[model samples]
Target chain A: MTAIAQQRKPGAEAATTRTRGASSGAAGGGRYATYLLPAAILFIVVIAVPLALNVYTSFTNWTGVGPRQWAGLANYRQLVHDSEFWASMWHSLALVAAMAVIPTVIGLLVAAALFDVIAKRFGPRLASVLRACIYLPQVLPIIVAAIVWGWILDPQYGALNVGLRDAGLGFLAHDLLGDPHTALLTVMAVLVWFQLGYPVVIFMAALQRTDPALTEAAEIDGATWGQRLRLVIVPQIRPEIYVVLLTCTVASLRAFGWIYALTSGGPGEATQVPSYYSYQSFFTNLDVGYGSAIATVMTVIIVAVSVVFLWAQRRHAL
Target chain B: MSAVLTRRRPARGKLARHGLAKHRGPAAWLVLAALAVLTAAVLFPFALIALNAFKPPAQYSAHGPLSFPDGFSTGGVSTFWQTADFGRALWNSVLISGCVCVLAVLLSILNAYALGIGRVKGRTWILGAFLVANFLPQEGLVYPLYDMAKAAGLYDTPLAVIIIFTVIQGAFGTYLLSSVLSTFPPELLEAARMDGAGRARILWRVVVPVSMPTIGVLLVFFFIWTWNEFFLPLVFLVSNSNQTVPVALGTLQGQHIMNPLTTSGAALLGVFPTIIFFLIFQRTLTRGVTVGAVK
Candidate 1:
């Protein structure tokens, strides 16, 4: 693959930089080759080869432990009929809403409130501290967040229920993670909590560059806070909004550690997303082919979503 | 600054003295109060972990979850570490993430040099490949890599994680550093070339030193990421001794499912390094969050 990629480079260079001959282009390519070699080799061995192999393996009937045979779309056919697969896809979409959309909206409000109102009224020091506090959860490992939240939601001695009961809200307290009906929503809530900081930080950073004069003019013109936020702040930070959306979209789709640590897709698969489902099918069930098919479909979906978002952004910009 | 605050102090104080309304209106106080509450809610879990980590079970159960611990005890913390073999796990994490940092950064510096400065042909394609590769979910790659690791006898070893993380991070590092280095002033490189410095020397002397700050930020991110990584380690390393910290804590959580004290202790132990890392490099971490979106 490296040789092929390298061989194709000079022809392109010769065409693009037309004044350069094939010999000099090859020499320039060789010079750059040494710089590119190590990353290319590692990328191929670890990522490219494995991904290619997965696409092939999806077509085969390979249990993880044994020899493989070409099954000819059997796995994909099984996925078409798999209720759990479709359910997980739905769950992922729900997570996208919970983790990406909801957080972006709330984060914008919080960050704008902090930067424009609180920072101005109180002090920058307080705002900085608050930003750090909000971002703290994001810095911790997902597994740690999962474990901490898992303990909090524990039925018997969990802090959440204990606090609820103490506060005389006993009727509201229940097994948030263990109940099938509430499990997925509960996980989504935790994810939203975990995700708020990313957008908050991103938006706040973007707001730092916002033209203060526009906001000042709006304020002086007796525009309401809501009006200023809608008409002034939001427009300045569109790119950051898109950034948060894309990052959180990928994050929620690939979210595993939290789900795995929190409930292990429990309460009878209520909280199971495709990532966890793929893990179960490939590793636990030893059905490598089925797992690979799920994984491939998931990859396609994620890439497709990304492309669509980028296209939308370009269109919006134009 | 003090003059402005002093001058505005009376008006702000008068607004506050009026109760709900303020210079900005009722929402000003409401938003501030709401933000304070949100900050508390966000920090509440960590506070729970810290407060409950050392509590004895009998005392903990008797006092209930919200009660302040009667006193400190290392018993739970010790138990968590011993059972989870956290010392081994911590060592494994350090070794693996350390290797990943070195390998990922080195490879990316070279690759970024090529793409960002070398202006190599097909640079855009190579860069696009790296960007797409970075976004490929781990689920899609883990199974095949699992098989490959088993084939190569690396499955359940630190080396497997090191190699995989290095590659994953190599893509990111390239994307980040290439953008960072691409912003390097062309005149400097031109001057170096005029002085007959070769590509390697120019990169090492001019580009590396000039880009060290960005590289440092990437290093911090890569280290925290690798240290906190849970999924790949869970899939790749099976044994207790070989498992990284997150994996070790995860195993401990499974075995001691009902023991919140141990879980809390292990959770604290698992996240301590990253907490320390963030506190130290807080600036860079925040910068990475937004600046990372830059092309």
Candidate 2:
């Protein structure tokens, strides 16, 4: 800006190093619309048209390449009666419990413990080191983690089973992932391991940024650690708590990489999720219309969830 | 306990040094011990990967997974790498993720300039549309995108994946940057504009430089997210030549070519590059997570 101002190319408004004219061009008045045209065009080309086509395709019957025939909610009616769809829906809710609700609860306690007790009594270095160890897995690609977990939970010659038998708890060992009874439970456990670090990192950072005086004040006022947590720390970080829950829930709701690598929807669809289910239909079954319907329904749920969270956030914080 | 403490002043810092941390002896040790156990539990899988990555298949079968390796071996890693053609996969990942990051950041900056700084008419609706559009999972767009990419003759190229992710990532970036820029000090824009600078000049010379920190965070996120992407790349990059690291590793799993040693080997192959990025950008990544948690 300064360089341009100094060129003085026979135009007006030379650079004046003064504090005047501050308010004139400060609130830029809408000549910026041309700048947005490129992004808007790209967005429409890439996402918007496809999104609309997806919704449209849901109401038609067509394979990947063919003339379309209108099915008009017939796919949706099929969705309602589909047992596997319901099971996948139910499994998605269970994942929300594992990845969002439970993690948030555990993360809050772990974060507070690390912040208040660990950092205070030990040092910031030790606390951050522990935090990093927990956070290390999160930075790895999800497919990698899923692959490693699949190996660990393998039915034969796997570590968990091998270790269990060695400890004379052989009865406790089973085919954790290959068995339908245990597949979803095993998958959910892996997700919890993968998901726990996010809330811990976010919540801990939120705690660090907030005024510590509040927690100290509660502590100095004869409040026990538990009471101080309830009265001071948790309430202080409510906005962060909300943010973590919303993002985690949204991520869990549409989680794909881990499931795709591990179960691929399963030993009898035990671990099927909406994302994987839709993919299977699209490519495996060649039922493009039904797949689009599943995806559209998923979009509706995610948008609804996001809107509710954002509205509540606006009311609470904004 | 002191009048100074109740005033919410610096005296609290003094008391904190000598206060709670000075007490709690056995309890503190117990807490430390528990945290150690928790860290070990969290790291159990990675530990398993490291221990098993070097074991030969014959020894792995003979001794069982729980046994210590006889010695180091690269047989598994080499075999998995050869089978997967990991060199090409790495190159493909680097190209795709890097292009997506650069393009997406520019798109984000431009979109944010209009909505946040220009305060364009109907900006709120535009922003909402972007949010909804991006949040619509890749599943919703996967089939159509596949068809479109095929129609455009981009079915098996890195360019197609690069272009698609740019828009998807850019939409979310626009939403985030708009909020950050809304509070951008208007005085800077005012001074630059008063100098007869055009919008383009001011954006590059002033707005972008000033907002570089947030932009850096956005860049880091875009690279990692694009690199980690699976479902879209799995569908679009059907040929082995264009496959990214995760795609190559993931698609090879059920091909009946894997054994226990190679499973650990494959996991390591997939995770190595990301581990380097995580270490290099450790602090920034942690900081970025909090920034991204905005309402």
Candidate 3:
């Protein structure tokens, strides 16, 4: 049976080659091969090679120096017992929750308000200016944003505390970054502020694509504003919702720079996300094998979540 | 009869419009007010930075919070250049960012074409791989790549920065460009083929020309990401001479522990190029991200 299947594949290949040749006339398959070479080289050298090396390193006892020895499942087993790794994983998940849910909710409200309320009164120029202002943080370097926020959130001499005292809201003014309990929340707030613009922009674009005629029709039918929104707007921008969710999820998982710049996983590992944990293992601890294992797991989680998202998207399309 | 009919019609129209217009009244103003409040919240820190950047060091230190600058001077700017290697750092940033943009754009265009137009087998798999690769955060591979760069003798060189930037950046570029490429009209490519054009000819003539807007978007996005990259350069580029602006600014902050004014000066200088670039290409940059998002 296997031999028969192989024989049948050869006949299919011959037919395909004949058709392909006839279609191309005289240029042959070489042109396509040539066109694909540069891309193939780039993919291999930059992407494929590094990825393969990483996977290999994950299975070894390499300390980023000296000879790498194959250790198979040991690294994976160790990761299962690593409390810091688990803590970091939870921290990362918490960050993702904050990053995904808050910005999305706020962005939806803002976008909905912009379309239903602001669009009529505000000129387009003003609307554009508002958008630019919101997106400024996103365009600025993350380090810069982190630094600016650091100054604002500084404990003693910071502007935020100064203003709070001036307004007699001193109780609200604590050491936001320096405190272990508040560090993660403060970082989350900064993340939400910086990322709010992304969802706003996407939601606005999606909202604009929604048919105003349908909305008008709904309005004319004596539907309340809430009913019109539920019946007309949300359904139209569903794909943008998925896109925002996926992008935010990934962004949250990859949180590093701001954490590095502001907290450095300080106050006793309070803000240590998985990415930072991975960095610590490799750089600070000189434990490459363990770090690679953590990284491999993260890669798997990211890929798995992304696959689920794309599947959902496909299901929605169907 | 005509006058009576006109008066009744106008009154009915006004009565009918009143409800919709009334619904739009207070709630809309409330949104504007809320937005004004949010804008103020967001703008306060940025305002502080700008205000401090202009003030003299003594005034900045001595003045009360939110106080106006005593006087404006270019002393900070001159001091930044003199005290720090601001010139070299700025040059290094521009060079690295420019090269990364060119390399990432070129690779992405080719890869996007292959995935989009070439009818390649496993195109979806390739795309999936790239997406997964993108999610592998920078810290994960930094050490390994650093070791590899050292082994290959590219460490502490601009080549090291360029290579690392191009490699990591290509992931997003591929994602953005492929999405853009997928939107190109298939009929146009079919027409090109029907005219006896080869794949290369079709790509160069039809696919590229039609995809310029997306390409422009990718260039700006890639440039921004490359310019803003910190971790890879921090780990890979060991020498001070090879330090990019962000790293240099970080170094200055660390070294100049006492003088908050000097640190601010350095930070201002470091951010100047990006501000200028943003001002100049603000329209394209805004449109690019929006286009990427919308699509």
Candidate 4:
């Protein structure tokens, strides 16, 4: 809420309150309702119809080309016992750690360092240049990123291996995306590298809004950097932290483009995330019904997570 | 010259903002060095791509991926460029993304104008629903959309992808933009009405012009997100001519994955435009993320 300085009212009333009170009436809704028509059409056709179709298809047996037969809860029943399904579900949590938890942790440290040291001590110009470098990966489509990374990590002639061989560390080189042991870890690292900039950017912005006086007082009181981060900076930007965690968590759960281009759950389904798994079931396995079920389940879980997160965000805002 | 370092209150007298003058020493240099190294690490792959894109495949194979290019070669770039049909892919991407951005922004403004400024009946529920809708993963919608597109005779068309993304991205844009616009100055709207302006005139003349910065931010996001999109494009765009850059490069990642030169060339192609975009919109890009986050 911007301070409505023009307000003649004795105390500050929110701009939002004034806007709402002044603009709204029965005629307002009736008149403006026409503006929503285009979006409503798009929403119904593009989001609503497809979503309803997906859920309904989950209960029926149909290949991509075929007539449907009711499968009832059979797909769900099978998924409950399916180890691969469970494994993919587990992989999502690992991705959340990589994409959300680790990035937020690293981003906080970096954002703080960038804000306190680079922005304040040196200059914001140098700090933002460094921030841009960290954020550079985000501009690439995941496929392009995965392609480059896949090349770098290729077992034989890839950059990492060739460089390693030259450095007399050839023995350490392995098929990073092919071998099961390293595949998921490699994927996670790529995600971390891709996602790190988001939180760094957000938290740094969040820090800008924080009361600099508190930080100044803490430093003058002889508090160490870590102590200042913990007690002063973190709490001040707690809301942004929650937002970052929530968005990144949602992004990780929908993680597909990286898995698709990097591994396709490959070298024997080693890096199979749920999205990729659902893709395989739909296109490769030709199990559209089963795929729909997997998709519906994933959607349900994500909606649940987002609803809870948004609720928490709303409460925290108050 | 730097306000951040220069801002001071003499009445307080004992301190500088961030206490920079007192703390200025080797510590600042150390932080700069650390940040430089981290930035280099993040950018290392891009540096490698630039280094290798100019080398011929055989030269790259022999050079162990570290040596400077042998007097500037374009063999790798031309090879991948021809093979990928990247020109067509680039055109397709531009077309689709441009359509999505404009259509989505228009839809967003209209939707947000109603929900935010008009304060329509049950606007809270509508906003909440839109928020949840924005979070729905593309996976659930893919197969049915695929099926429906076929039925509607729209599969493999750029229009199909454009239409779908317009709605999804527009919904999200609405959710974010509504929050930004809800607090729009009522005085401006009322004043416009006093001039005998109607709803459309007021929205276009009053709301949009005032909210240009936020709308600019949304346009940048829509373009990047649509351009970066892979799944729906890959699924919907089956024809070679219809495929976007990411889909073309992604689908063919297998054939060229082994040849380090061609892969680097492809990476360069896929990456250079983004680099340019980042350079151009660096400020807006950084600020855009926080807009949706904090509010």
Candidate 5:
């Protein structure tokens, strides 16, 4: 009986091995195609098909309902002289710059203090609560945030002006969204406020992972807090910093929903980002070919910015 | 007790050597205060929105921005519910987001499993493709998608929104899950194989159970993202009944801008589900964002 059991065990093992080998071989050869098929089909049908069509449509002068006349590079050429497009792109850059600088600097400091100083007492609980509160805006649909902000910044009977008058600071209260001068700034402020929590959380998380012993050693060697921070903590989380910068840049460039909801790219196209401009060209103007050109330019800009940022990250790593 | 004393002595010695103990005192408080202020800055706007929701439309504009509503009223809430297609929009949102969450999670799991565990060629390229696709702005493809959806007779349908969202979302979903899967120890997978489990059985019995937390996190994230999506739905669903909450809210805002009462009421109604969802998944969402941070 013992001999028979031993033989049965080996036989079962061999069978399993054979099956595993066969299956793994098959999976190695064609499993990606099988597993990837659903996503691929969906991407092709939905994303790729549209992307291809967009490229084709960009070359042609096609309204939403008409036969296409090949415009070749006219759409692209027109975009060069399209002052509105250039202005919107400039506005987008300003927004990205504003978002990156303020949030990153504040977030880093807050994260450092949270981790290094306040970590001993109410750190974990406070971190969680603060995180939730900060991420609250992320969950609110952009329209609600924009509209509520609109009311708060309303020139007439707006909350901001009302409070400002009461405090004898009424001079600072402009019709923020209505004035072309302040419209971009107001929109950027709202964007920054909405996005502040995410970076804070990200920074906090990255800060926690920073090695305490390194900071302690630097301290023991008489390095000041600021010096230690510059040398040790910043270098350690460079990758995270890069990620935050890239994400913030992308987000600011794609600043559509709030701009749409708040100003509708108005106060005379002052707050018009490329995204809103593209949407206007496509749906409002019903100029498919021109819209496609605008969108393609937007895509190229995003891709270029991302590539540059990534390259900078790699350069920093080296 | 001995270990605690030893640790304390060293920390005290270090502080004394640096003469930094006094400086640390106010610095810590300063840090705390700054964090508190930042937190308040973020929370106050949402508070304004919440406060306004409970007030009468006239009173909301009449009162100080920070003032409490004159009286809490379900009048606006009830009116929002009855007059608008809020209910149907909410149902459509729930259905579409739920379907997207399920489809994305399932498809991502298979792709992640194969890429993370199975010996597959071109895995790096596949991942790179997904990353590039994810980073491509949605506007780049919107017109083409609109044209294609129209050609296939899918324009103005919920399915059109679902398919577009699923594909766009899946790219990122796959990337996140694949990273999570790569962290799963290979030893356990090998052990499961040695224990006579087949690939399907291993996935079901071991991989799924082990990766539950990640799966949960992805579900909530995907659901929230899909639920909050506006532009795609706005472009695709032209029919009033097919309008999701965000699109409906946008339309409502345009139509009722002159009527602050209905507009504020609708805005309040539109944001309710999202707030409720956040509260429900607060724990998971927090953990999900901070997961790779510490470890």
Candidate 6:
């Protein structure tokens, strides 16, 4: 449905410049071009210039202090052998699994069930209410989500442990975020919870375009819900599935704020991701050059993934 | 169509003869149970925070972590406010998010107008840069921005956080508004120009009035994004008085890592405004999932 919505809108304004009379049109266009100035200036100062400076600083020994000395790929060389860099990279991969793969799979199942069975038999109103409930967490700040989970995983008095003990599963209770063995897994679970709502909402939007008659006919034909979802629903929502996957992957790549609040990349760096690691190197460790290197590498990875996703989408779309 | 089918079914007495309960009973139960559990999972943490925020510290520590408070009290919230200097933090956050909302929305109108309807040269490059900038993580720019802010004497100030949030959030706002504005009817602009309306007059009188709903949606999103923003504020604002709610809560977390009541209270303080905003604009937010995710 959204793909269709996107298709309906023309790509760019093609005739606005010439729609007016010829005499004053050039002067009018010049004045309109001035409208882009403020945004351009702000973007240049805040984003483009800083990013260029970041690349430049990665090659120097700038330590958040005075002048810089050019060290020429030394930071990149150090990053090659850096154990923490490699470890954080591994953590990011794990995060991609937790935040992207698992959420997409589960969100699809929940959304399908909601649309096919729940809404079909009951009512759309009920399904929407349920959708809103599941989507509640997405609107919250990531930092707040991490803090709430931090409280839940608090070793001494977390609700998670409290709930486990209350349910007579005390053996399942442990220092979820304090023990290195389970720290990363615990963080992953919380991040998964944070990401669950997004894909569900996206899929639900896509499902609006599905013909209920087809689902009803498939049902009368003795097709199980799973078969119907596989044979009918998934194909119809492939574009949205790609949308969720790409956006979630990009989100996981940019992960930092919440992880820092949750673990501070702690329990001996068990939950350290590239973004957090970069932050540590910059702010805490005061190693700006190495930090910039970590950041530049992260940016490259993100941009690469985005490019691949867009390329793939273009091919499939065409 | 489904409504018509359902209405005709009861008139035909098909429901009574067939007894729909045979098919709907177990399936409905299962779906309801699953949805109930999901709702609980999503709301449990907020329930915990709301419950714990009201408990006095002594009673909070005496009881189980998941236990309900013995009685409601404002002690924890007041104590958290004093402990974390949340008044100033709240003021700082309000100022930052408010300015960001206004600036981002205003700049987006300009940027979107130029790119969306003006047919300006290089519009493609400008839109592409803004869209790509939206995906670039703050981590990539944090170090350089920190240095730049410090050098410019804007470090540890609300103005620094405000400007950074404005720039970052404004980019997304521009992207969203441009998509919405690009669909504006060209005939309307022609009609306005035929009546001798200038560019400025047409923008405020025609474009803005027609796009108010979309602009309203962007306003809500930008405010929430700025208000919930953590990383940039953490990097830019270092002083106690300068911190936003989230950053202040962060600092308080490090200080009172062991105090659940205080931390939970502080967390509620940090999240209260966002919850209010979401409740007020819940329809817009839920509907926006597609726009936000797909874009």
**Per-residue accuracy of model 1 over A202-311 as CA lDDT, tens digit each:** 99989998866566656656899899999999988887788789889998998888788888888887988899999998878988899899999989988887777766
Give the candidate order by descending DockQ: 4, 2, 6, 1, 5, 3
Superposed by TM-score, candidate 6 places the C-alpha of residue B126 at a distance from the truth, in angstroms, of 2.2
Minimum summed lDDT over a 10-residue window in model 4 chain B is located at: B4-13
| Per-residue alpha-carbon lDDT of candidate 6 for residues B219-247, written as tens digits (9 for 90 to 100) | 88888778788888888888898888888
lDDT of 4 at A255: 81
* iRMSD of all candidate structures: 5.3, 3.9, 5.1, 1.9, 4.5, 4.0
Off by over 4 Å in 1: A1-30, A314-318, B1-25, B256-258
Candidate 3 deviant stretches above 4 angstroms: A1-30, A70-72, A167-172, B1-24, B73-84, B182-199, B251-258
Tens digits of per-residue lDDT for model 1, B250-294: 776766653767777887786688889888999999998777864
Reference-based TM-score of each model: 0.91, 0.93, 0.87, 0.95, 0.88, 0.90
Cα lDDT, model 6, residue A162: 79
Residue A282 Cα positional deviation in candidate 2, in Å, after optimal superposition:
0.6
Q: Local distance difference test, per candidate? A: 0.84, 0.86, 0.75, 0.86, 0.77, 0.81
Error of 2 at A52 (Å): 1.0
- TM-score, structure 4 vs. true: 0.95
| Residue pairs in candidate 1 whose N, alpha carbon or C atoms collide under 3 angstroms | none
lDDT of 5 by residue, B39-105 (tens): 8888776666677666766676566556778787766667766765788888888889999988888
Those runs of model 6 whose alpha carbons end farther than 4 Å from true positions after fitting are A1-31, A166-168, A217-222, B1-25
Off by over 4 Å in 4: A1-23, B1-19, B255-258
lDDT of 5 at A301: 83
Candidate 6 displacement at residue A209 in angstroms: 3.0
What order do you get sorting by TM-score, best first? 4, 2, 1, 6, 5, 3
Residue B50 local lDDT, model 6: 85
Q: Which candidate is the best by DockQ?
A: 4
**lDDT digits (tens) for residues A1-318 of candidate 3:** 644897897687557545543554344433444555665676676656776677788899977778999999999999899787787888888888788888888888887777666765665566666766776677777776776677677776667787787788989889988898988888988888888878887888788878665676566668887888778888888888888898899888877777777888867888887887887888889888888888878877887898898899879967
